[model samples]
Target: MDWQAHARTLAAQIVRPESRWFEPLATTPRHTLVPRWWDSVDGQWALQDGARDPGRWLDVVYSDRTLVTRVGPVHADAAAPGTVVDGLPTSSSTLPGLVVQMFQHAVIDDDTSQVLVTTGSGYGTALACQRLGEQRVTSIDIDPNLVATARERMNLLRLRPDMKVCDVTGKLPGAYDRIVSTVSVRPVPASWLALLRPGGRLFTTIAGTGLIVTADKTEDGGAVGRVTPDPAGFMRTRQADDYDNPTREVWEKAQHADGDSVSVSRYPLLYVPDSWAVMSMLALDVPGIDHRVHEDGDQRTVWMLHPDGSWARATSGGFLEGPTVHQGGPRRLWDALERIRNRLNREGQLPVYGARVTIAPDGETTLSRGGWTVTL
Candidate 1:
């Protein structure tokens, strides 16, 4: 089976009918960029030896699922064929569908345009280079090894983009007509606005949420746009491991909460990933909302928690009993959710994708919709 054929099919699945990325996605050789990857199995990430499974490799490689190409600081190139390291997925060539959607948002012009995209496994960089020539693209990544490997991969295809080992969270390499980030960001880095020329567009995913923002650079050093209705999960920009091993006390409480303080809930089950509007609204309003989804046998569980000491759990249980909720911090978790829901009830809809963003030069962000404004 030709991996190129598979890549074409994968691209079709991701590119929208009205998107211009279709032609590029269909022609680019994505498998060459992601020669080997790590796959999740048994709740653990294991190395998937592409060379060993050459026959089945293309199937996994082109699938919409994320393939981890680096662990912690270790690139998959250094590891042996069967080596498996479990730290955290540090880098990857994001799923094809997501890449296409992001590019679609970018709205790249075919008339002598330059775009800056974060170089991960170089798959996205390859796509951009394929769409817009190598000279028209500048790809940067924080990890030097990733840049080096990506350069090699691009060289193999004879498609050389300006691959640089620079941190996108800081200064960008050069001015660009469009900037698209695969990595999620807590705040739209001021450097992005500085890099973009006037009338330029910046497309990126909001860190810690599934919100996709497409903003245009304004003359006053700010950008604004309505959130994309499509939901996505980008690896959060990390200085290091972005997780903490739960303390014994916290673990115990999560496993066994006190009664009355946490009563069983009665709410319809909703996956945050599947609810772009509600999730985006919550992200803007609540700010720091962490979520975890657990699946046991036939049951699915979702836990939503905010930094302000509010938590909600919606199990597979019926809505009559409500959700197992706990709130004691400054901001009430369930109350906040209920408030958003009540607004939706009264207004007949929630403003999430429609939320307007005003990114200031000082890096302050304000999200407003229907007269309600949240600043972060």
Candidate 2:
């Protein structure tokens, strides 16, 4: 397979003809960065080796989709074939289109601007290098192994950028004209504001939701901006070996408990993650609801679990029918979801998108729109 040709074709499909990113996307060898990755199969993460299946590898690599390179602490390169690990994706090469879109959001127009971006597969870093010279680009990741491997892969392509292993939430390596994070965070890190030059811009999504915030540094050690109309979701930044796994006891209970309250849902069963606006609002309001869905023939079960011992389970016979909900613990998880859905139905759109975003020096974030305000 002609991987270069395929990449060019993908670039044409994803980027506009007049975009500066067109050439970068067309030339970058994504296959080299993700020669081995994890693919979900039968509810298990199976290792996919590119060298073993060149055709399948070329197709996935050139396509505009995310490839999981690490699950928990297990890098796909070290996993044996037929190996299956059931865990969350810890690292990945983000979709090419999204990466380009984020770069566009960062407004990297000047060749002199020093840009700092999160390094996952190093694919985005490579693109940045192609657009703005390698001297002006710096990529950082929390995992040392990922940073080293990314540097090695970029070296193979003869595209070198400063790659460092450091927690992005902490002090940055250097001052930059722009900081674009593909990873999400709860509160906007104060270090980011400190590292930015006076007019420096930052782009990132809120953790666990599809809220993309584009802000510029202020003189008062704060930043002010509005959420983008387009939605984006990224994995949360982690300083440890891996993210904390949800408690097994809570999941087991939520799976088979009658709960403290039971009633028929007024609205049909809905998955929060399916709708960008709805999910963003819920994440801002409730903060940390873990969502799961199980389907058996015509029966569907949806669950929302919070770390605070709150869980809600909704079950329905068919797609159009309302679900019978069971809730337990302190917060009524299902009711909260329903209220958001009700607002969506009445207002025709959630007020989250394009809302005013303000981040104080102390890391307090407030989103205000139409008299509704949420502080994070």
Candidate 3:
């Protein structure tokens, strides 16, 4: 396969030729790091091995797409042929465009050294190694198998980063000038602050939202920056072997079942997840609510459920039309969503996207813009 040519084409689309990331993205063999991956088909994971069909493999690896490397606790490389599983994705080789985009937000420079980055499929770390040199990169993952597998695969590309098994939210391996994570995190981890040099920076997305946060470390062991214009989402940082899904009870309680109060919405039915601004704001104002959608022909229903037994169900004749909303539990979730949507309609925008972020040493984050402020 003419991998170099394809890589160049991909790099052109992902990054400008003059950008430092261009050469790295164009040269790194992503296929080497992700030999096999999972694809969701009919609500189950179907494994695809690159070795079996080199042609399709090259196309997939070279394209701007994410490859799921692990689902539940199953790594695609170790899964047997004809393997199918029902589980949420645990890890993936992030799409190349977003990888470079997140790195660009970190603004890694020649003076920056000893960078700490997440090691998922090792593709991102490989790009870092290609750009900053392996000696300056320290990559980590909580899963030992992922750490070992990523280390070996990267070695095939003649790149060997210092990969380790460590939860990014806990004590880190070493101090560094820059840290970038492809995984989404709730509170910006305090360990990142403890290890970051005073003048260094870190970039990551908040879990359950598409907000990309970039902050520069302060002299007093804190950091302050803004939510960049770009948006992204990744798997939450898992401390254990796999991710825990939203409970079935939340779904059962919310899905199709009527609620304590029912009424028609003032506005059109909007799936909160599809709108980054709405979702980010909703997540900030009311945390821990799981959003789900059910569709049948022209009719669709959206569910919002929280661990505390709060739930909102909205059914629409069509996705774009006003919905008949039902709310129950400790709080009215659909009401909160309606307020956010109302604010969007009234003010024309939400502050969640471009809000300035201030992080304390303990990882408590405060976001403020205009007169709106929220903390996580």
Candidate 4:
């Protein structure tokens, strides 16, 4: 297959020819790096092998979309045909557009600037290595198998960077002038601040929110920056092969039970997952909400569960009508959401975006925009 032609098409679609990232995206073989992936078909895992059908493979690989390379602990490369497993996505080759966005946010401008990048499918690292010399990039992941396999894939492309297996929140492999993570982080990491040079920038999305934080290191080892107007949602960093859902029982109980108190909500029964802005603001205020949606015939139900034994269920007529809200446990999860949504509707915007962020040397983060401020 003429992969270069497809790559060129992808580059043109996402960037201009004069852009610094155009040539790298136009030449890198994403198909070679991610030959197999899983596509969710009817909520079930469906494996897609590139070699089995070169046409479909090149079409998907060259497209500006994320490809799931692993679910739970099952890597697509190792899964048998028609194999199905129930688990969340553990790793992926992030969409080329978002990869470029993350790198561009960090301003990885020079070949001499040492960069630290998160390694998932390693396609992102390839782009970074292409932009900055291979010796200038250090790639890391929590999974050893991923690190090893990605290293092998890099050699196949004649692009070798420093690849290692380590939890991104812990001790890093080396100091860097720039750090860009494809994974989400919470409160930021002190290690990142300690490792970055003064004036060096760090870019990452906040956990449970699509907010992008761009902070530059200060001389005192802290960083000050703002939540850029970019929206990105990446899986959070994991310390193990798979993630654990601690709020499953709370969801089960909340899903079928009548609430301790029931009333009509002032808002419609909107699917929380589909509303990024509302979901993000709620996450900042409430945090750790396990959102679930169920639709039956002409009725719809939205379930919000928290590990704190708090659960809220809202049933709607599925016709833009207000929902009957039922809430239980220590906190009123839906009530908190409504409060945030109320502010959004009242003020045309939320403070989570374009908010100035101050990160202490210990990774304590405080975000402030105008009179609104929050600590996470």
Q: Write the per-residue lDDT of candidate 4 for residues 1-376, one digit (tens) a residue.
A: 8999999999999999999999999989999899999999877778998999999999999999999999998999999987887789999999999999888888888744799999999999999988888999999999999999999999999999998889899988678999999899888999999899889999998898988999999888999998988678999988988988989889778977988989888877777778777777888888888888878899998899998999999998766688999999999988898898789889988888899999999999989999989998
Write down the worst ten-residue block by lDDT for model 2.
Answer: 241-250
Residues 1-376 of candidate 2: C-alpha lDDT, one tens digit per residue = 5789989999999988788889999989999889999999978899999999999999999998999989988999888887889888999999999999998888887554799999999999999999998989999999988899999999999988888989999987799989999999999898898888887889999998899998888888888999999998999988787889664557889998998999998788898899899889889888888999999999999899998889999999987888999999899988898899889899898899989999887767888898989999
Query: Candidate 1, clashing residue pairs?
Result: 265-321, 265-322, 265-323, 265-324, 266-321, 266-322, 266-323
Alpha-carbon local distance difference test for all models: 0.74, 0.90, 0.89, 0.90
Q: For each candidate, give its TM-score against the true structure.
A: 0.86, 0.98, 0.97, 0.98
Name model 2 segments beyond 4 Å from true.
none
RMSD of 2: 1.1
Steric clash pairs (candidate 3)? none
RMSD of each: 3.1, 1.1, 1.3, 1.1
Q: Which ten residues in a row have the lowest lDDT in candidate 1?
A: 242-251
